[model samples]
Target: MQSTNLKFIFDHSAAAPGHQHDARVFSESLLCQRLEDGWRPLPQGVLLGDSGYAMRDFLQTPIPNPQTPAENRYNAAHKRTRSRIECAIGQLKNSWRCLSKLRVKDPAYAAEIIKAVIVLHNRRMDQNPEDLPAPEEEQEDQCPPEEMGTTEARAAGKQKQNELINFFVR
Candidate 1:
């Protein structure tokens, strides 16, 4: 890939067309289910993440070697770079009342609208990247991190989360 190429990582919420959306589990592993997708990492890659995408399985599972100090540095940078996606989401939601409103009466129509919006976002970006600004965080939340689940999974997730917390603390 060329150095000029930029990467984008946006969060996805899998709310059934007409169903009410649950923000907490929108992108959770059991709920969102995108880990199995084909996503191979590249040296020049960047990943944008949100509170929902802040899981070991979600970030580490998809990208190669996502559990290391070097990986952590890369992910932090990616997080900053990807902040633009969050802003894009915010802007789109603000601009399109339908996006943030109650789901469309027709599930299929709602799904179609959501897809169309995503496509429009991409097209708009292609036209100009300056339209969306990056997001800024004022404070932190008090979550233990690495959502608790599975024995082996818990160990790994807890260990990684602890490492990150310690890193930032220092």
Candidate 2:
């Protein structure tokens, strides 16, 4: 599988099931690859994700200064810069009904569905930027979990892993 596509670009894909893992893994791998390629982490920190891409690992790296009252200010700034994919996802989900339904069965074919969704989303975005919602004043964990499928809050780690507990359990 091409890891390039693994990099989440949003679009109509925001609505698919079993997508939380793919989005997170893709974001993680993308960021790690950038780091390996010599991208430096800012001290006050860079908050590098949008909503769907959040996983515990994303938070493991200290965000500049975690204790500051300006909590995640820098990350939020960075987040908006990286939010085009997120806007595309939101718009795609809101605009396309097919995306809301995971009609494909085979895993490989499912990849095609995702690609199609993103491509459509990008095209739409190009045509009408007005439809997309702005990435919020500050990116916070919103949107309740998807029925049984849920997400864990990410805690930044200085080492390799950032472990987070699911809000679903308790």
Please give the lDDT score for candidate 2. 0.43
For residues 1-170, write the lDDT of model 2, one tens digit per residue: 11122223432223333545544444445554564344655533333443344333323222433454343554454454455545544555666667668766675677687687666656765677576544333344444321221232332332223111121123
What TM-scores do the predictions have? 0.51, 0.45
Q: Who wins the lDDT comparison?
A: 1
Q: 71-168, model 1: which lDDT tens digit per residue?
A: 56745755565544445556556545677774557766776677677667666668885765443343322333334345665355446555544555
Model 1 quality (TM-score)? 0.51
Clashes of each: 0, 10
**Index of the highest-TM-score prediction:** 1
Off by over 4 Å in 1: 1-14, 17-54, 57-85, 131-148, 162-170
Name the TM-score of candidate 2: 0.45
